[model samples]
Target: MHIQLLGGFRLDCGPGPVHVVPGARRLLALLALRDSPVPRRVAAALLWPDTTERRAGACLRSSLWRLVKPETPLIVVTEDALVLGAEVDVDFRRACAFAAAPGASPEAVTMLKADLLPGWWQPWVEAERDWWHQARLRALEVLSDRFRVSGDRHHAYQAALAAVQTDPLRESAHRTLVELHLADGNPAQAVRQYQSYRTRLRAELGLEPSSHIHELVRPLLR
Candidate 1:
C-alpha cells in the first residue's frame, strides 16, 4: 500500500485508490507522517485540540471506526498506541530520502517538486510543511551545485531556477541561479535575475540583496 502526503493525501492498494473521508483523512495523514506508534491519548489530543480529553478520545474512536475496512486494514491499534500498518509506504519519507542521496535522478527530482500537503492549516501539519519546504530547497541547491561542477549546465540551471522559484526571497537561491546564468554565458540573464530579485526583495522586505549576492553579479554587470 502507498500513502502519499506530498502535494496531497492519497492511499492506494493493489486494487486501486481507497476512498477516505475528510475527518478520517486527517487522522490517517498524521499517522502516516509520524511513522511510529503514538500513544492513544497523544494522538487523540493532537487531532482534536479544541476538545476535552474525553471528547477527543471519542472522536478518535469514531474516526478509527470509519477507517476500518474488511478487505484492508489500514491501521494497527495496540492497547495504548496507534500506528499505520507496517506495509504502508509514505511518499514524503521516500522523497526526503531521495533528496539526501549522493546522485540525482529524474524520479527523485520529480518527487522533490511536490510540496507537503499544500493548504493544510492544522498546527500539527505546519512544522512538517516547513520542514519539507526547507529540505527541498536545500536539495535543489545541492543538486544544482553538483550538476554545475559536473559540466551539466542545463540541468544545473534547471535546478537553480527551481530553488529560486521555490523560495523567491531566499538570496542564496538567487545567487546560485545568477552564478549558473553567468556560467552558461548568459550575463544579461544573470543581471536580469539579480535585478528581479533586488526589486522583489526591496518591495517585500524593504531590504537589498546581500553583499555576497551582489558580488556574484558585479563582474558580469560591469
Candidate 2:
C-alpha cells in the first residue's frame, strides 16, 4: 500500500487506485503526514478546527465509518488514537529521507522537488509544506557545494540552478550559482547572476544582497 502526498494525494492499494471522497482523503492525508497514531481528540480537533469539540468528534466518526473496512483495514484504531495501517507507506516520508542526505544521486532530486499537498491551504498542511521546502532547499545547497568541491561543475550548476528556481530570493542559492559560473571560468555569467539577484532584492524587499553574497561576486563586478 502506497500513499502519495508530496505533489498531491494518491492511494495505491496493490494493482489499482482506490476511490475515496474528499473528506476521507483529507483524514487519511492528515494521519499519513502525521506519520504516527494521532489521538482521537486531537485528530477531530484538527480536522474540524472551527467547530465545537463535540461536533468535530461526530464528524470524525462519520468519516471513519466510511473509511474503516472489515477486510481491508486502512486504519488501526487503538483506545484513544488512530494509526495508519502498518503496511501503508507515505511518499512524503520517503522524500524527507531522500532530502536528508547531502550527496544523494541526481535522480533522487525528483522526490525532493515537489510541494507537499499542493493547493491545500490548511494550517497543518501549510506548516508541513513549508518545512519540506526549507529542508529540500538545504539539501539542494549542500548537494551543489559537494559537487562543486568535487569539480563536477555541470551537476553543481544544475543543483544550484534548481535551488534558485525553487526559491528565487534565497541568497545562498544565488551565491552558489555565482560560484559555479566562476568555477567554470565565466566571470561574466557570475556577475550577471549577482546583478540579477541585486536587482530582484532591491525591487522586492528594498534591500541589497548580504555582504557574504556580495563578496562572492565583488571581484567580478570590479
Candidate 3:
C-alpha cells in the first residue's frame, strides 16, 4: 500500500485507490507522518484540539474504526497508541529524504514540487505544510546551484525561478535567481529581479532589502 500526503492525501491498496473520509484521511496522514506509534490521547488532541478531550477521543476512535476492514487494515490500534500499518509507504518521507541529498534525480525533483496536503487548515497540518514548503524551496536552491555549476544553465534558471515562486519573500531564493541571471550575462535581468524583490519586500513587510542583497546587484546598477 502507498500513501501520498504531498499535493493531497491518497491511499492506494494495489487494486485501486481507497476511499477515505476527511477526518480519517487526516488521521492516517498524521500517523504516516509520525512514522511511529503515537499516544492515542495526543493524536486525538492534536487532530481535534477545539473539542473537549472526551469528544476528541471519541472522534479519533471513530476515524480509526473506519480505517479497518475485513480484507486490509490501514492502521494499527493498540491499547494506548495508534500507528500506520507496516505495509504502508508514505511519499512525504521519501521526498524529504531525496530533497536533503546533495543532488536529486528529475523524478525526485518532480516529487518535491508538490505542496503538502494543500487546503488543510488544521494547525498541525499548517505547520507541516510550511516545513515542506521551506524544504522544497531549499532543495530547489540546491538543485539550481548544482545545475549552474554543471553548465546546465536552462535547468538552473528554471529551478531558481521555482524557488522564488515557492517563497517570494525569501531573499535567498531571489538571490539565487539574480546570481543565475548574472552568470548568464544578463545584468539587466539581474537588476530587474533585485528591484522586484525589493519592491515586494518593502510592500509586504515595510522593510528594505539587506545590504548583502544590495551588494549583489550594485555592479549591475553601475
lDDT of each: 0.84, 0.84, 0.84
lDDT of 2 at 4: 91
In candidate 1, which residue ranges exceed 4 Å CA deviation? 68-72
Best by TM-score: 1
Comparing 1 with 2 on lDDT, the higher-scoring candidate is 1
TM-score attained by model 1: 0.92
Least well predicted 10-residue stretch by lDDT in candidate 2:
101-110
lDDT of 1 by residue, 28-52 (tens): 8999888678899998999899989
Supply the global lDDT for candidate 2: 0.84
lDDT tens digits by residue: candidate 2, 1-109: 8889977899888787788777778899998987668999998898899999999999988998887363667888887999888788888888777788666467656
Worst 10 residues of 1 by lDDT: 101-110
Pairs of residues at least 3 apart in sequence or in different chains that clash in candidate 3: none
Q: Over the stretch 53-136, how does candidate 3's per-residue lDDT look in tens digits?
A: 999999998987777463556788899999888878899988888788847346666777788888888888888888888889
Error of 2 at 193 (Å): 1.4
Q: Model 3: how far is 57 from its true place, Å?
A: 2.8
Residue pairs whose backbone atoms clash in candidate 2? none
